[model samples]
Target: MSVALPACPSCQSEDVVKNGRTRHGKQNYKCRDCGRQFVENPQWRIISEETKGIIDRLLLEKLPLAGIARALQISELWLQQYVNQKYKLLEREVQVRPKPKSRLRVQMDELWSFVDHQGNKQWVWLALDAQTREIVGVHIGNRSAASAQALWQSMPPVYRQCAVIYSDFWSAYELVLPSKRHHAVGKETGKTSYIERFNCTLRQRISRLVRKTLSFSKKLDNHIGAIWLFIHHYNASLPANSSCPL
Candidate 1:
């Protein structure tokens, strides 16, 4: 019986031979040409595909990295590396998606996040698409009108032209908003309730978003990238219309 040995992973040669058995009794092989030793199923190989899947989901979904590692019995470090690599690659082309240009009754709100800069806590602003429950944009420093303006500028041309922007009594919205769009900022208008409610959803889903935590981000840049990807997938999962069914 010819024992099945894969081509040398190191040299890609079929002229391979059985070298020995591992401590775990898995068959090990040797490359006749390169003389490099390897196993049909390398120890690292066991987690490679699984690690890729975990990282893919982490990059594409809103799940916590630690949670994914725990569920897959994979190392958190492995997932983090893949997540970071993909994050960097996508960041360049990860401009805002082309959403519907039609006017939306969208609710916009900002949340304060704590990030470390020179050992001091800095604030991060968050803006979300309430209807799809997607994070539209994020900014660093004070959640002021300037910050809001920057966030709006970062949005795709489609989102920038929202018919009506629903926000709380934050003066920043007034200063940053254009005269054409209805930027209502009052309690009775319930302008910001949509995003406020979505905040609860985020708090429940991820410990990182929990307001109680003094540290809100593991890495500020990576966290923002992760949030952007999450919103992309989250919006994808939403119903086609993205709002109450007609």
Candidate 2:
């Protein structure tokens, strides 16, 4: 009779030895090759990929953090951590993806949201490709020239050669954007109507962005993370008919 032994998880080596038992009474194994220890039948601390998919769907549905936790049978702290980690990765991916090759006509605008129970307001500055309906850049901070500049700088270099940038008559827009490309117009003139409608879509799809809602973020970090997640998902989910280079 032969007994089957499990391979080391760290190195996938058969050179593993019993190292006693874990606190939970699971059998512990140590890999001689890598000098790493792991427990057999270990309790998983990280969220599974299936749970991540559910989380992504719930986020798009504009569910509150607490509500999502309750629905998934997980702690709010765990869910928050998971979301932050995932969004940070998505942010890096977005930053490194290939930039659009052609020059773009863009629309820029800001939307308001509050963080913390103190009602400290934060502004979300967004730049959208007017023709493609794609989000090109995003910045979150106080409504000031610095935030506007950051938003403008966040845009891909390929988009900076814009034929015209339609924006409202916000002083920050004038201060941060180049004078030659900027076109500050009134909202009633339909210059920035596309971005304004996108703002409404954001509020409808992201619970934390909804005005006058109990789903507001209590921390600035979490608020920013939620925004990144929504932007990445939203851009990926756009219909082919509504995509770039119109």
Model 1 lDDT-worst window of ten: 89-98
Candidate 1, residue 134: the lDDT equals 52
What is the C-alpha lDDT profile of model 2 across 212-241, one tens digit per residue?
888888878888888887788777766666
Q: Taking the tens digit of each residue's C-alpha lDDT, what string does model 1 give over 1-246? A: 977678998779999989889898988888999998888655463567755765676545345677777777777787688778776765522233357777665566666555543343434455656565555665655656788787666655666776466676677877886757746676566767767766665565545556665435668767566555655555555666565311
Error of 2 at 158 (Å): 1.4
Best by TM-score: 2
Clash pairs (backbone) in predicted model 1? none
Which candidate number maximizes lDDT?
2
Per-model TM-score on C-alpha atoms: 0.66, 0.74
lDDT agreement with native, every candidate:
0.63, 0.81
Look at candidate 2 and give me any clashing residue pairs: none
The candidate 2 region of ten consecutive residues with least summed lDDT is 91-100
